[model samples]
Target: MKHVLVTGGAGFIGSHLADELLAQGYRVRVLDTLAAQVHGDGTRRPAYLHPNVELQVGDVCDKEAVVRALQGIDAVFHFAAAVGVGQSMYEIAHYTRTNNLGTAVLLEALIASPVAKLVVASSMSLYGEGLYRDGSGGVHGNCERTLAQLERDEWELRGADGGLLTPLPTPETKAPALASIYALGKYDQERMALITGRAYRMPTVALRFFNAYGPRQALSNPYTGLLAIFASRLLNDSPPRIFEDGLQQRDFVSVYDVVRCCRLALESPAADGEVFNVGSGQPLTVRDIALRLAQVMGKPHIEPEITQKYRVGDIRHCYADITKARKRLGFEPRVKLDDGMAELAAWLKDQAAVDRVAQASAELSARGLTV
Candidate 1:
C-alpha cells in the first residue's frame, strides 16, 4: 500500500509510526481528536507530528470524518481510544463509545470502502495477569487476585494451594481475563475488527502492545505510559508513586521497535489474520525501572514511593512472549532498555514535565476505584 491512514496518529506512538511510514516513501494520513486531556484544550496540531502527514481534526466515532479520512487510504491503523485502566472503570460509557463504538463505525466504513489491510491496536491489559508457573514448572494462565486479597496487602496471585504463582511470559494464547473497562474495550475492538474482517474477507491484524515508551509523549497525560508518569514525578521533585510493593514485572518496549513491528504487519502477508504480541521480550520490575530512570535522568536521590495501596484492576505481573511475532513477522526489538531510557531521558529534559498524578490518584480514590 502506498497510502495509509492512522487513526490517533497525532499521539505519541502513532506519530512515530507515521514518521516511519513517511521515511519508507509512503503517504500518511492521520485522523485524531485533540482531546483536551492530552492536548491541553488546544486546537493547534501537535508539533511532534510529522510535517508530511495529512492531519484530519476529527473523532474516530464520526462516520463522515472517518470516511473522509479513508478516501485515498490503502490501509488502516486504528490506534485512537480512551486509554487508561483506572479512569475507564468510572467513565464506562465514554470508554465504550470512544473505543468500542469507534471501532464499529470504522469497520462499517471499511465495509463500504474496503482497504487492502486493517490493523487494530489491542492491549496486553486484556490478559489481566500474565502466565504463571508452579514449582513443578507447570505453566498456567488461570490467575487472579481478589480485592480482599489486595486489601489485606497480599500483592501476589496464589494457586489453589495458596502458593505464590511465578510470573511467566504471556503468549497470545493466554485466555483473556479483562478486569477493567479499558481492557474490555481494547478486546472488543480487536474481536470486532477480526470478526468483521472474516465475515467480509478483509485482511486483518491485531497487535497486543506491552508497556511502550519513548519520545514525543505528553507527560501531562498521566495515563499513557508509566515511565512518563515516573519522569514527571521526578521532574517535579517528588518520588515516583509505585503501587503494590513496586515489585510488579512488565515488558517495556521502545516505540521505535513497536513502529517497526507495525510496519511488518502491514508489509508481510504472513501477518494477516493473526494476532501478535509487540514488546521487548525482557522483563523488569517496576522498582528496577523507577530506579534506572532516576539514575538515567540524573535524579538518583528521588527514590520511588511504594504505596501499599493497589487499584482494583491492577495486575501483579505481565510481560510479552514475542516468539509468535518473531517467527511470523520476522520482528526483533533492537533498542536496549538502557539505550531507550537514555534517549527518553534526553528528550524529556527538553520538554516541560509536570506532576498531576497525585491529584489524579485522589480522583480515582474518590471514585472508589482505588482501595
Candidate 2:
C-alpha cells in the first residue's frame, strides 16, 4: 500500500479525506497544528478523526515537522492553510505567514524528499468575480464591481452598456482575479506547489474547491463557510444574518465529493500538472441556502436576516464549471444539496457552536471591511 501524507488532515476536509484514504488501504499520516480557531484550545487529536490514521501534531510552516511527516510517505496532499476570506483581510500577516510561508517551507522540504504525487488544495476565492455573460452572450471574465458601484448598493455585475450580466459557470480557463488576502495566499500556494513540483519532477495537481460544507465544519468559527455560519446562528436560536440582499450566488460541494476528487487526483496520471475546479456544478442563492439549512435543522421559523451590507472581498456570484474535473478526473458530485444539508443538520443536532457571527461582523465593520 502506498503511504500518503495529508497536511492539515485534522481539519474538516482533510480529516474526511483521511478517512477515505484509510478505507482505500493507504497508510495515511496527517500533519496539522490543530489551530485553536478550528479545534478549540487543545492539542489532542480530534475525536472525529479516524483512530487508525497516524496524527502528527505540527505546523506546516515548521520545517522540522514537515520533514518528519514526509518520512515514509509516498505522496502528499497539501491542504494546510489559514482559511477565512474575511479574517484574512485584517489578519494580513497571520494569513501570509501560515498560507504562503507555510507552503514555502513545505515545498523546500519536498524538494529534499520528493514525493511521487503532490495535490495542493486551492480555493475558488481566487476567481474574485466568476465568469459573466452579457445579454448578447458575450463572455466577460474581467468583470468587477467598482467601489463606487458597491457604495451605490449595486450588487450585480454590469456590462459597459449598463446591462445586467448573468453569472456563468466559471471554468479553469478564467484568469484569476485575486480579491482578498486569503485568495492571494491560496493562489500563491497553488502556483508555488506547481512550480516546485515541475522543477523537482514531482507530479502535482491543484484542486480549486468551491464552498465546501458538511459534518466536520468549524461551525463556531464565523470566518468559515456560509452554511456553517448560518447553522451556528440557528443553533444559537438566532436568525441567520446575510449580507448584500442575500442574492449572491455560490456553489456548495459536499466534503465527500471533494475528498473523492482528491483521491482521484492522487491516482490519476491525467490530473498531473493540471488545476481542476471541484464543486457540485449547481448554483444556489445565498438566501436559498439559508432557508434550506433552517428547514433542515427544524428551525424554519427562524428567518434569515438580510442585511443590506457588503464585505470588501465579497463576490456577487461564482460556481464551478466541473466539466474539466468530470472529463479529466472522472469526478462527479453525487451529494445533492438537500441530502447534504440534511446530513449536516443531523450532525449539528449533536454539535455545540458558539455564536461568534456578531463579534466577527462587528470587527469587520469596525475595520471598514463591511458596509
Candidate 3:
C-alpha cells in the first residue's frame, strides 16, 4: 500500500483530504500539532484514528518531527498553514512563520527523505488585482476579464445609473492580487514549493483553491470560512452575518471536489510542477450563498445581517478558470454550489454525531494513536 503523509490532517480541509486518501487504498499518515487554536476545546484530535491511519502529533516547522513522520512515506500532501485573509492580516508574523518558513522546513526534510511526490495547497490571492494597465499593473482590464466570465452568475455589472452592465467570469490566469498578509504568505509558499521542488527534481503540484467548504469545519472557530459559518448560523436559527454589501462574489467549491483534485495531483505525472485552479468555475454572491443555505435547510426566510465592517484587502469579486485543471488533471468538479450547500446543511444539522466522531478521534489520539 502507498504510504502518504498529510500535514495539518486534523483541520477542515486536511481532515477531509485524509478521508479521501484512505478511501483510495493509500495507507495514510497525518502530522499535526493539534494546536489549541485549531482544535478549539482540545477536543478535535488527529484525523487518522482508524487502524489504517498512522498519526503523528508534531509541528511541521520542527525538522525532527517532520523527518520522523515522513519516514516510509511515498508522497506528501502539505495542507498545514494559517489560512484566511482577514485572520492572517491580523496575525501576520504567525502566518509567515507557519506558512512560509514551515514549508521551507518540510521541503528541506523531504529533500533528505524518500518521498517522491508532493502536493501543496495554495490560494487564489496571489494574483494581484487583475487590472488592465499600460504595460503596468492596473485594475481596469484585469478586472474586466474576471467580470466577463462571471456574467451569468450572481454578480452582474451595473452601470453608474444602476443599469445592467456586461458581466464576466474570473479565469485562472488572472488571479486577484493578494490583498492581505495571509494571501501574500500563501502565494510565497507556492513559489517556494515550486522553486525548491525544481532544485530537488521532486514531483510537485500546487493547487490554488477557491473557497473550499464542507462538513468537518469548526463552527465555533470565528475564522472558519464563510460557507461553514453560514451553515452553522442558519442551523441554529441565528441570522448569518455579512461583512460587506453581500454583493461581493466568491467561487465556492465543495470539499469533496477539492480532495479529488489533490489526489489527482498526486497520481498524475502531468500535474507535477504545475498550478491548477480548483473551483466550480461558477461565481455566487454572498447574498445568494446565504439564501441558498436557507433554502437548502428548508428554513424560514432568514437573511444575513449586513455589517459595515469589511476586512482590509478583501476583494469585491473572485472566482476561477477551472479549464486548466480539467484539461490537464482530468478533474471536473462533481458538485454544484447548490448541491454542496445542501450537503453542508445536512452535516450541520447533525453536529451531535459529528461531535461524537471528533471526540472519539480525540480520545484515540490521547491514547497514543498519535505520537
lDDT of 1: 0.92
Candidate 3 overall lDDT versus native:
0.74
Instruction: Report the C-alpha lDDT of model 2 over 76-183, residue by residue, as the tens digit.
Output: 999999999999999999999999999999999999999899999999999999999999999999989888888888888999999999999999999999999999
Q: Please identify model 2 stretches exceeding 4 Å from their true place.
A: none
Could you give candidate 3's per-residue lDDT for residues 46-123 as a string of tens digits? 443455667788899999999999888899999889876656655778999999989999999988884688889988
The candidate, 1 or 3, that scores higher on TM-score is 1
lDDT of all predictions:
0.92, 0.94, 0.74
Q: List the residue pairs that clash in candidate 1.
A: none
Q: Point out the higher-scoring one by lDDT: 1 or 3.
A: 1
Off by over 4 Å in 1: none
> What's the C-alpha lDDT at position 358 in model 2?
98
lDDT of 3 at 308: 42
Q: Can you write out model 1's per-residue Cα lDDT over 64-174, one digit (the tens) per residue?
A: 999999998899999999999988988899999999999999999999999999999999999999999987778888788887888899998888888878999899999
